[model samples]
Each structure stands twice: as C-alpha cells, then as structure tokens.
Target: MTRAPAHDLNAEQAVIGAALLAPNVVAELAGTLAPADFYRPVHGRLWEALCAMQATGQPVDPIALAARLADSGDLGKVGGAPYLHTLIQSVPTAANASHYARIVADHARRRQVADLGVYIAERAGTDTDVAEIVATGRAILDQAAAGSQWSPLIPLGNRRHLPDFPGYVLPEWVANMVYGVAEFTQTPVDLAGCIALAALSTAAGGRAEVEVRGSWREPTNLFTVVVLPPGSRKSAVFAAMIGPLLTAERALVERTKPAIVEAELAARVAGKAAEKAANAAANADQSGRDTLLAEATAAAMNADAVTIPVLPQLVADDVTSEEAASLLAEQGGRLAVLSPEGGIFATIAGRYSGTPNLEVFLKGHAGDMLRVNRRSRSPEHVEHPALTLGLAVQPDVLRDIADMPGFRGKGLLARILFSLPENTVGRRKIGADPVSEQVASAYTANLGALVMTLAEWTDPAVLPLTPEANERVLDIERAVEPRLAPGGAWGHLVDWGSKYTGAVVRLAGLIHLAEHLRDGWGKPIQAETVERAGLLGDYFAAHALAAFDDMGTDKSTRYARLVLAWIERTAATTFTKRELYRGVRSQIPTAADLDPVLSLLEIHGYLRQLNAPARTGAGRPASPSFLVHPEVHGSAGTVHGLPGWASRRPA
Candidate 1:
C-alpha cells in the first residue's frame, strides 16, 4: 500500500515560528539546516526567506518577515501575514528551536530514503550500466546521510600528515649545502633536498646502474618536482643548489677545448685533400681517370672518418619532448632538464600542438629505447636513454597537469618524486644570513669533481650492495607489496608506490658515491646508506600523499575541487543546478556532468540541497537549489569542503 512521504507538519511549523519569535536561533542552525528540511513547499520557502533576511542583518520578527516575504511576492503564497503570527503562536517556546529543527531534518531524510527506493526500482532493469546505477544510488544515500542530524560525514580515505624531511639521510657535504641554502633562502628544506637528489642524478645518471639482485637493475636517474607558491624564492634555491652543476659543465667544456680544436682542424685538412683529389680525377685522361677516381674515393672516406666532437651539454632548460630526445641522443643518451619554472609540463601537454607527446618523458625515466623520426631532421635512436628532471614550480601546476590526457595513464606522473613543501609566503625573514663562502666553494668543488669523474665512463658500472644493505631493501619490498592491494594504505597510489623501493635503491647508490667521492668505483653500498635512503623514501611518501591529494588523485575529488572553487569565487550562498552549471560550464559541460560533483560536495559538508518546488502539469520539475556551508565563507576556522590533510600547510 502507498503512503504519504514522511514529514511532520507540526515540527516544521514550530521550527519556523520559533525562528520568527527568536531571530538569533537561525545563526545556531546555519550550516546544519537548509530550507529543504521543511516538508511543505511554503514552509521551506518561508525558512529560506528568514535565513536570507537574517544573513543581511535584518530583524526576523513577524512584521519584518511579512514585509520581506511580501517584497518577494511570497507573503500571499505562504498564506499571508496572518499565517506568520499563527506560526509564532503555535510553538510553546523558542528555546527548543534546535530540537524542532533536528526533527524537521530527520523527517526530510526519511522522505529521501523512500524516494531512493523508488528510484532503484525504476532503474533495476534498463539499458544503463548496472555499476553506474549502483554508484548513483549510493551517492544519493550518502547525500541523504550528510543532511542528517545524527550522522556527520567524514572525509574518504586515510588522512596522513606531512612528515619532516630526513636531511640527515644525505651525505654530510650534501646535507650541509641543503641546510645552508634553505636557511639562506628562507624556504622549506624540502625544495633543496629534492633538487639535491636531482643534481646527484644528473652527475651519476646513465653512468651507473644499481643491481638490487641478479638480473634486476635500477637506473640511477630521478625525476623530482618540488611545489611552492609564488614569491617563495624558488629561483634562489634552485640557483644555490644547481650552481655546482653549471660550474662543472663549464669546466668540462674548457677541458675538452683542445680535443675539439684538434678534431675540427683534422676534418678541415681531410676535406681539402679530398677536394684536390676529385679535381685531379675530373681533369685526368680516360686511362688515368680510373686511378684518380680511386684516390678521390679514398680521400673522401678519410674526410668522413675525421668526426668532429659535439659539445657536451649536461643540462637543458625549457625544451619540448622532441628537443629533449635530440639532446639525449647527442649527449651519449643522457641529459637532465633542470629548471626553476615548470614549462616542461605545458610542452608535454601539447602547448605547441593539440596532442600530448609524452613518449620521451616515459621512456627516459625507465631507460627504455627511444627512436625519433621527425619530418626535417635526421633519424635519431637512443639505445638506453636516461633523463633526470629537477624542477620547482607553483602548486597550481600540479593540478593543471593532472587534467591533461594520458598524463597519469602513461606513467609519467608516476615516475616523478613529488614534494609539496610548506609555503613560506608572508612569514619570510626580511634579512637572513647568506650561505658561507666556505660552504659554497666546498659544494661546488665536490659536485664538479663527481660530475667530471662520472662523465668518463664508457660503460655503466653495476653498483653492488652489501649483504646487510640487500637485506634492508628486501624488507622494504616485502612491506610495500601488501600495501599495493586495493584496500591497503597505498591503494590510491599503487602506481607511484610500486616504484618506491626502486627509487630508494637508486638513492642509495648516489649516497654511496657521495661518501667515497674520488674512488667510489671500488666501494660496495653499505647498509647505513640504504637505511638513510629508506628514511628519505618515507619523507617523499608523505609528501607524495599530500601532493596527490592536492592534485585530486581521484576523478570525483578533482571535479569536486573545481565546483567548490567556483562556489567560493562567486560567493554563492544558494544556487540551482542550472546556475552552477552556467558558472562552471567550461569545465562542467552539461547539467548531467554536475551529478557526481555535487554529490561529492554534499558528502564533504560543502553544500546541501533545498526542497524542490511542487511540480505542476509540466515536462520537468523546478531545479533543486543548494545552500552553501557557512564554513565555506571563512566563518569557520577552515574550509571543510576539502579533506583534513588538504587544509594542512607545512610550518
């Protein structure tokens, strides 16, 4: 048998009457109550009018509410001013308004659950996918629970805190520079630490590989991106850390100047001799022409054999994928793209063309072979390419690149080690001490020595790990394997976590080399070095959690952030589905696209829907309006629209 939708006429009338008698009662119920909680349409409309008037600092007595309702042509619609007084008189006292409001909201949720049952019944057998139908149904129930008085919504997933950087894990010299530069720039040490690893990658990458076990080799290359907002002095930090690499690159060029000069001169002399031989062959008689032709061929072969050396380029900035690939091929299949800005993502996202080109970035990180065939350029092939990336970019760049197609699916984002350091804006010291000259010079000399020594290797040396070190790596692998499962802590980050242990092994190799410096070739990596790398690994894992969460690792979370940003920008207290669609039309194309996004916001205490206006004999019902949470306006200490970890910033 059919029954009326769940509602309490007395409770709804009493709640409204209590608010009319005592205006301050509305403020206590701002976030928890919405007009839609009232069962009757007219009562819901009256509640909305009361909240709106109180929000503008107007009185909410019978006379004021009557005038306000009359102005909106709702006075007659809600049964005139007489009904307002009747409502005031209906409630025994205004003290129990909170209790009455909860009752009203409870009835509203009951009605929604009844409607949900009907919706599931209607969608049980249809062309729509069953999984999609189930997901939508669950979203409706979650939204209904979000509006309940007894149940408050908690954010999805485990919220983790940002861990402090393990600076001691680095070799002593590298740790000194990292600390000095961070203190000098007044930025987070995280930026300097990540860039330090990338600098080590540039020095040792492609020159060595870590043999974790038999037939399992990990390349000593890394892709690291540090995120900071503007005015954080990223350039200053980058310049301080990368200073040694630039100096070392210059020293290499200067040291190779004599060889380059000799090769160029040899090629020019051979070309001249080949020209003379050809000229003689053209002038010779038929009998002598054959012998002259042979001499000319031999001379031309000699000229071609005298190959000129290409300039050594250890670093490149602001390059497209094609340009990076070409530089790698020319530089013995090794290159590092180190930059203060993150324009490389824009290029990879197809800033030049409409289609994304991520082949080089993917293959470069994995040491996979890359064959490039461009229209007007010579064919280039890299047998084993290794590219290192060290960049400092604004926090918004992470969010922007996550939306690019195939950016995640292609494993490009997974390959990177992300660090979201605490933003230091507005808190920086006016005058901080600069890095000591002694520290600066020591860093430059040691880093330059490492780069020059590594550059001479014709074949990559396999880095051996001591028994204790190998055991430590095995322990980490065993611990990480279970977490990659769908319900584990690393479930949301399986792709990045799968490579975490490998990244630690590579870090161990770099640390071991730094410790020995001059004669690192003879040393086997120690357990202490591997332990230090593991600590650094933990630091990165915590930061990656924050970074990916900010990037909206899940599709629903990402879209929800877009919708919430719009709500904040427009200061929308109450809006219909149509209104929100128009506000975020570019990102949210149609009304249907807003379903999941709105549902997500509902789950996070951002917004709640108002009661739908009664339907007449029409094609469609009026659009449902939603009340934006008071916390969204900074009235609350933090924006509750996002998860807890998302609101946290590094101190």
Candidate 2:
C-alpha cells in the first residue's frame, strides 16, 4: 500500500488559502485550530501570523501582510508573496472553508496520534503516577478539540491572544471621542466603552419608534454585553463614558419633576372635589342634583384626560419586567438597563426558578408589543418597547447563567453584542498621569450633546437608508449569510449570525446619528458606517461564540471527553466491556451513558469492537470486548492493564 507520514500538505495549503482569501472568517476558524496543528512548518508559521493578526484586530490582507512579514524578516520563509497568492487562489471560494477545515483537522489528528504513540511508549515504562499520566493524555485530547472543550478562564492575562474585538477603526469624530475617554481615564481604550455609549445613544433615539431596514425591517433596539472579569475596570469605564447620557436623563427628570408633581397633586385635588360635589348633589332637588352632578362628572373627565407627563426617566438598573414596560411606555418606548451586578441576568432568567418569564424580555429585545394582563392587577400594554440592555458580568457569573432555558434556543442571548477583553490590571500603574481637563471636558460635553439631542427628539423619525446605504445592507447580508449556511465552518453559530446582519444595520443607524446628529445626514447610510458595523459584528461574534461555546457544548461530546480521560488514565487499550464498565461506572454510571460514549469513541476512530468466542468454559459466554488503538489504547499484542486481553485480543 502507498503510504504517507500522517500529513496532507494539500489540505494544509487549502485551509491556509481559504483564510487568506476571507480573513473575516478567521475567528470562527481559529476556535478549533492552532498553529501546531498544521503539518507543514511554513503552513504553521502562516497560521500563527494569521491568528496573530486576527487576535490583534488587524487585517489579514496580503499587501499589508507582505510588509509585516518582510519587517519580521520571515517573508522568505513561506516563499514570500507568491506563496500567499497561491494560497489565496488555492480554492475557488471560501464556501469550502468547512470542508478544507475538516480535512486539515483530520490530518492534524493523525499527526497527533503518531506523536502520542511515541509519547505513551516511553512513559509506559516510567515510574510516574498512572493517574497523572492519564490526566496529561486527556489534556492533549482536549487541545485537539478546543472548539468544544469547557474550562475555566482565569489568570486573565493569559487570554491576550484569545480573539480580537472589531478591528474596524472608528470614524475620526467617534475615534476622537473615544480617544478622550482613554486619555482621561488613562486606561486602554476598550472599544466596548464606545460601543456601549453608541448603543445607548441609539436606544435613546428610540428603538420602539423606528425600524431601519433594507429589504426587510427589524427593531432599532439593541442588546449590548461587555463581558470581562470583575475589576477589569468595565464599571469605571462605562460609568465615565455613559456618565453624560445618564446625566442628561437625570437632568430631564429633575427639570420635569416639579411639573409632574404639581399636575399629579392637582388631579388628586380635582378628584376629591368632584367626589364631594357628587355627594352633595345626591341630597339636592332633582334639577339641582342633575346640574351639579353634570358639572362634577365633566370635571372628573378633565382630570382623567389630564395625564401628568411622567418624569423623564430613561435608564433603569433594578426593575421587574412589568416596571420596565411601564417605563418604556411612559418614556416614549425607550429605556436602557446598564448594570455591573450579575443579578441582571437572574432577573432576565426569572425571579422564580423553573418558571421563567423570558417572553417579555425577548419581546423587549425584538421591539415587539408587550401586553401584560394579570387577574388581580391593572393590565399594562406597550405597543413598542425599546429596551437597550448592557451588562458587565464576571466570566464565572457568565458561565453560571449560560445554561438558563431560552437563552440560546429562544435567541435571547444570541441577540447581544458580547465583548471580552484580556485583563490589563497588572500593567496599569498606580498614580498614572491624569487626563488633561480639556479632553475630559470635551468627552463629557460631547455625550451631553448626544443626550440633549435625544431629549429633544420627541418623535424620533424612523430613518430610512439612502439608496447606496441600502445596497450596503445587501452587501452586509451577502457577507454574513454565507458563513451562516448549514455545513459551513460557522454552522455551529448560525443562530447567532441570523440576527447579526440586521443588528449591524441598526448599529449603523446609531453610529450615523451619533456622528452627525448635529448636522443633517449628507447621506444617511454611508458605506463607512455599514463597514464599521460589520467589523463590530465580526468582533462581537468572536466574543459571543466564545461565550456561547460554554453554554451549548453537546452532552455526548462532554461524556466522550470524560471517557477519553478515564481511558488515558488507565493507560491501556484492550479490555472486556464489563471490565472497562466497572472502572468508569461511577462517572459514566449507567448503560445509557457508557454505550453512547463508547460509540462516540468508535465513531471518532479511537476504538473498535472485536468479535471473538471466549476461551473460558463452554457455559461461559463471550462477553463483548473492544480493541483500543495502540498508542491511544495500547500495543495491539500487549494490553498493559488487562491480562485477559493478552490471550483473547486478536493479534
């Protein structure tokens, strides 16, 4: 038989080429793969650079990359620009990325198996703890499947190269504003801070009142989540950046507080007066009573129509679904939930366990009408409620609530822009230089302007995209949909991608409004605006995928992982089904768990069944057995841990 050394150079080249052609797909592709997984030395280097660029929010374009590679003195390593060109033109389209990815991954597994055999052979004779050796082996398997593994995200600094936020540079005006934030806070400018500010500004413009669509319409409201560990300065950054918007909201309430109170008191007084007059009228003569009662009834109607303009409260931290709806209704169908507390998730999860009230929150995200009818209470109805939600929970807290029902399947969690940055704590200096007053003042003043503009926007127009901008919307769809197709590399995250295109348009509207809220739109939907939104979508999807992975890892895959660990720990290959069953019964527990996991191993080519009659007495039947692959299981003729396998296992 013709044989090769467990590597497919063609598959490696195909994967590298796919990425070179469509760099935007890097995040999803990178999740399950790494540089070391590549068989070719040059291909490994190329992948490393691709990942580096992607991780740093940098473009992976050829011209830019050629210059970078030349600077790093490694352009000659991969045969320079021509090789990159070859890789780009290797495949006809990126649609085959999943196919190429699978082929490359399969070769990577073969390579791993080859190396693992040598590793196990050497260690088999060592005096090391068998459990420790097995643990090490399981860890190697986990690395092979990083895309589906679940583990703690601690020592945040190590996450520096995890994945990148949107690499799209902000518009000069917006960039200038964010620059001021970084300058004053003396903190690394988290793009999320700016994203949060923009989302809130747009929310205030009114999600309920507007739907910006291309060929289709979607709610203007957005759900934003800036995920990071506690003490990552999310709260401080958000508080500062969002401070002006909140201030304007508070100022509106304060300015209108007196008038609202006066109107309410007047209504109460009018109600009492009407009641007294009715009582007196009841005791009077017929004509007198009728006239008095008429006057009192007219007064009551006037009082009823005199609905006091409620205080201009637009942001809420702690509130129930009913109250949030009431606020949305009262505040022109716009409100934001900005909180550092994790309770926000629980509230969204539901006040009581087992029974979740997610429909209201889901509707709020969709800008759908919410009508609450209670048997014992006044019904509350909102035709369109725009709820802009922002939460910064620690990573651990995120994992805890990830399993909440309806979070993934119902698309509640999928509709969010999730941002998780590497920790920057140790690098920050005590008593760093303070931000100059001018920049800080400008930052706050700019937000104040946005908030004021929002306040003045009594009936926020449902802005339509300009013709060219509408084209860009199509472009965004074209760009995002291919990746969402079934059997695509990103198929696992298609649900998240489903809402992503529209969300980008809504965000484009927000960015447009923020920059040119003062001046009339030159063209409401600029190409740059849509492009920026696309970049943000890409960036946020990276984080969202990472977060969602913890929640949606398949159960059988998880059990398969556990089974692999046990097999590795035992450090042996051939054994009767019952013997292996006894060893793992505690964790695997029942036949249901064991059977599927064993099958999974077989499907993955790690194990296979052996058909044989037992050497035991005639009455003793042939119990089932498995032939674990050598290197993974043990040498074919020599089963290390099980003695019966030496005689019974087929040579």
Candidate 3:
C-alpha cells in the first residue's frame, strides 16, 4: 500500500477550504455528476463514515456512507449525482490534495466538538444552593440569547453577505440610517411607511424633494406625490403605500388653513367691537350718576325737615290729609321713611307732632322714601327720627354690604350671636329664646361627637371645613377641657364604660383613631405604641363581641373557644397558671364572656400562644416569653392609651 506524502496531509487548509466549498457544493455542485471524489457530498459522507467507524473501532465501509446519507436525508436534496461529481473534481487539485484527508478528519473533530453538550451540575459535597445556581444559569442563557451571534438558522442559498438586487440597499441598513437621523434630530417619526421610504431614499443617496405652488384662487382637490427612482420595483412598492397617505395629509392642511385664518380674523373683529361698546356704556353710567346726584340735592333742599321714622307705628298712622301734604311740601318735598320692622318712629315738621298716624298714608303710598336721624351720644344708636320724601333708595348700599369682606349674612351673624349667653338674655326676657347656653353646650358636645363619628367613617373632606367651623368648635373645646382627664375626652369616655360598654367604646375609638390617622393626618400608627396604650386589650374585647355577633349561635362558638385556648396558653407564659386563670375568670365570669373574647383573639391571632412554655403542675414552670399576634392590632396596628387608664392599672 502506498502512503500519502507529508505535503498531502495538511489539516487547517483542508478545513477552511471545505467550509468555503460546502455551500457551493450544497447549492450548485451537489449530486449532478459522479460520486466518490473528495469534495463531493459522497466523499464528505464517506469521510464522516470513516471517522464514525474509527471512533467505534470498526472498519471503514462504503455501505456505512450510503446508510449515513440515507439517515441524513441530504443526497436527494443536493442534486444526488452531478453535485457529488463536481465536488469530487475539486479533491485532486495539488493545493487541496495534501490537506484533503486531514481536513476531513478535522471536520469530524469539529463536528464532535459542536455536538458535545455543555451541561451545568451542582458541585458535589458543597453547601451551594441548587436554586441559586439554576437561577444564575438561566440568566446566562437569557443574556446569550439576547446577543446578535445567537440567531435562527437560515437555508444555505438564502444567506447573503451583500444586497441581492442591483442599486438597492438592505432594509436593515436603510432603517439604521433613518433611526440614526431621527435620534440625531431628536424628532419623533411615527409613520412607519414614511420612515421606511425616507430610509430607502437616504441610502440611495437621494433627497426627499418637495414642491410648493400657490394660485390667485384657492386650489381645489389639492394633492402631493413623492416621485421615486425609475424602474426600482422595490421603490415603487414603497411609493404605492406612502404616496397617498402623505398626499392626503397635505390636502387636509391646505383645506383647513383658510378656515383657521378666517376664525382668527373674526376673533380680532369681535374684540374691537366689544372695546367700543364698553367705552359707550362707561360714558352712559357716568352721566346717570351725575343726574341722580343733582336730583338728590334739589330734593333735600325742598324738604322742611328730614326726620327718620323711629318705629313702624309712625309710618302706619295717619293724621289730617291736608297736614300730610303740608309736611311733604315743608322740607323741600321729601317723602316719609318706611320701616319693615315696626321699630322706627319718626315726626314730620309743620304737620302731625309726637308721631304721625302713618297707617293711612302708608296704605296708599308706594314710592322711594328716606329715614333721617340726629347723631347721638352713642354713635351706633339712631335718635330723633324723621321722615323725608323724594330721596332715591340707591341699590349701592346692598351692593356694598354684599361686597364687604368676611360678611357671611345677617342670619348667620344672628345664629352666632344667639349662641352666646349675653346675647340670649334679651330673648330670654321676652320668653322667646331659640338657643340657650345649654343648647350651645349641647352643640359643642355634638360637634365633638360628630368629629369622632366622621373619623370612624374615614371621610377626608371634613378637615377642610375646619377653617369655617373652627371658632364654633373652639367654644366646645374650651367647655370640655376642664371635664377631660389627663389623656383627653376620648380617653376618659373609654376608661369609664362598663366591661362590655368599655369594649364597645374602645373599639369605636380605635376605629375612629385609625380613620383619623389615615384620612385626617394621612399616616398609620405603630403596633407597639398601640399595645403600650392598652388599645390592643380593648381590640381583643371588641373583636370577641364582633365574632359573637357574626356567629349568632353556639355553633359559632368554635372561634371563641380557639381564642380562649390561645389566650390561656399565652397567659400561662407570664403568670402562674392559677393567677392567669383567676384573672381571666374574674374578667369573664361566664363561659359566654370567655367565648367571645377568645374567638376574637383567635381570629385576630393576638391571643395565640407563641413559644409557649409547657404547663407544670398547678402553676407555670417559669415566665415564658409572650407574643401578642397582629389581628388584635387592627389595620393601623396602633392602640392609643386612654386618659388615666394606664396609670390606674394594678402593678
């Protein structure tokens, strides 16, 4: 047997050359001609078969090559005979002959390397967590999958390093330029088709040209079109999609532009008209004011006397008809003042004295009048009242009153005034008091109660009314301050209730305080603070009642039983079993009492024993650590201490 020369046995060159030739062999040179030459699929198949035989320590066989090709299913797909012959022709070239066999061996080795599985297993005898290793491995796989090199495989002929068509750029290359420009300009390009076109045009070294033209008359059915390179079938496809869209957009702008311009012009015209009208109205108002002032002066001069009516009786009575006319004529012709409240009394000069019988005069008269009064020792007091006529009752006074800063209304002021004991005195004398000191006190208490009620409801809009209601609330605050014990009114109220009542009040207070912290102050209180404040104990009591209310019968007693057991277990940790039992039995004399508290505690997890000590004979062995579970803590997990309750607890 003749051995191949050393020059005919290079490995690296063979591998590179084979890799280069593999695609051509698969595409153009596979199976059209003879078989058995080196570069042919059959040769590669035979070499692979030989390597497989070597690995298994078996003899090389042609049947094995045929079997391998049958199994791989590549022979029919790669032009079967002609492709094999063409590939085989390349095997005898002098440059390839030296490296061919070694290259085949190297290919087998490379295939083996690629096929070898890279599995990760936890290290043996190490304390490393398997979960952590698995997590890290998954993360590595994810990162590798995200990189460009790890991509889906395409068919041999379909893969290309350059553009397939002449004068055309790859879509990805054009997209990159478009995106790069968008990024550089910092302008968003949302139209995907337009962007695609722009990218294509940019890559082709062409500009996106536009033409604008105007006519003396507005253009109708206006449109725009983007002309693309001639004979570029791909460009034509892009133009077909993007051309109409851009044309429609331009047409819409042109159509709407005239309407927008007209609207702007109309707005300016309306503004000018409004300015002229405002100036005319101003002049008219000034002229009216001057005329009214002059009329008022002439009327005052004509009246013999201007006496404001002291009371309504003065306007209600009538004296002589002729005397009434003389009184109206005496003081430069002014009319008598009218009073809605029968309080104002007045005298008319040169007519009826001491109070005129104004009932007859008031019956027939319906015109503007005036009430004049002499200044008195007390500037606020109205005295020496007389009636005058022809004085215009200007609306400015009411307008001024309405415009006054912080003037709520007369009724509101009266309500506030009547709330005071001093202001209530006059009404009390008349036996017509509507609101007394007692009523005010009740109102204050009700205000506090309402605040507590609102807190329980978790309504936030309540606090905004504080500015308006603060003064009224302050009155209640002052009255209640002396009655409140150290903690506050809320604390005193809770500590003073009966066992059942105390539980209810405390629970209600807790609900209120929780809501106040959340809605009023926008914060949550801490659990430790609640426990220290004795709120937890109250919650335990309340929760028991709530559970009882829900369960409604003895069948519902299961939760209560669980809570009691937990509490007993928990109590066993801190006190002697007898002492703990005694204290519980005293507070809860009936099984009924024990059941509810227990149920509530269990439901809330507050009564549950955690790390409880084992029971010893007659008493607990030692002080066991106590764990008060969270359910008794409520949502905010805070228990506010009642006033005087903590300090009064037995040591």
Task: Say which candidate scores most in lDDT.
Answer: 1
On the 0 to 100 scale, the lDDT of residue 180 in model 3 is 36
- Candidate 1 regions exceeding 4 Å error are 1-153, 156-159, 283-291, 374-378, 553-651
Q: What is the C-alpha lDDT of each candidate?
A: 0.82, 0.65, 0.29
* Higher-lDDT candidate of 2 and 3: 2
Across 465-517, the per-residue lDDT of candidate 3 in tens digits comes to: 12322233233335434444564423333222222222222222222232342
- Cα lDDT of model 1 by residue, 324-437, tens digit: 988888888889999989999999999998779999989998988899787886788888788999999986688888888898888888988998776666567878899888
TM-score of each prediction: 0.65, 0.59, 0.15
Per-residue lDDT over 485-576 for candidate 2, one digit per residue giving the tens place of the 0 to 100 score: 78564687777788888788777776666666554233356777777877777666677766676455555665665566567768756677
Order the candidate numbers by lDDT, best to worst: 1, 2, 3
lDDT: which is higher, 1 or 3? 1
- The residue-level lDDT of candidate 3 at 173 comes to 32
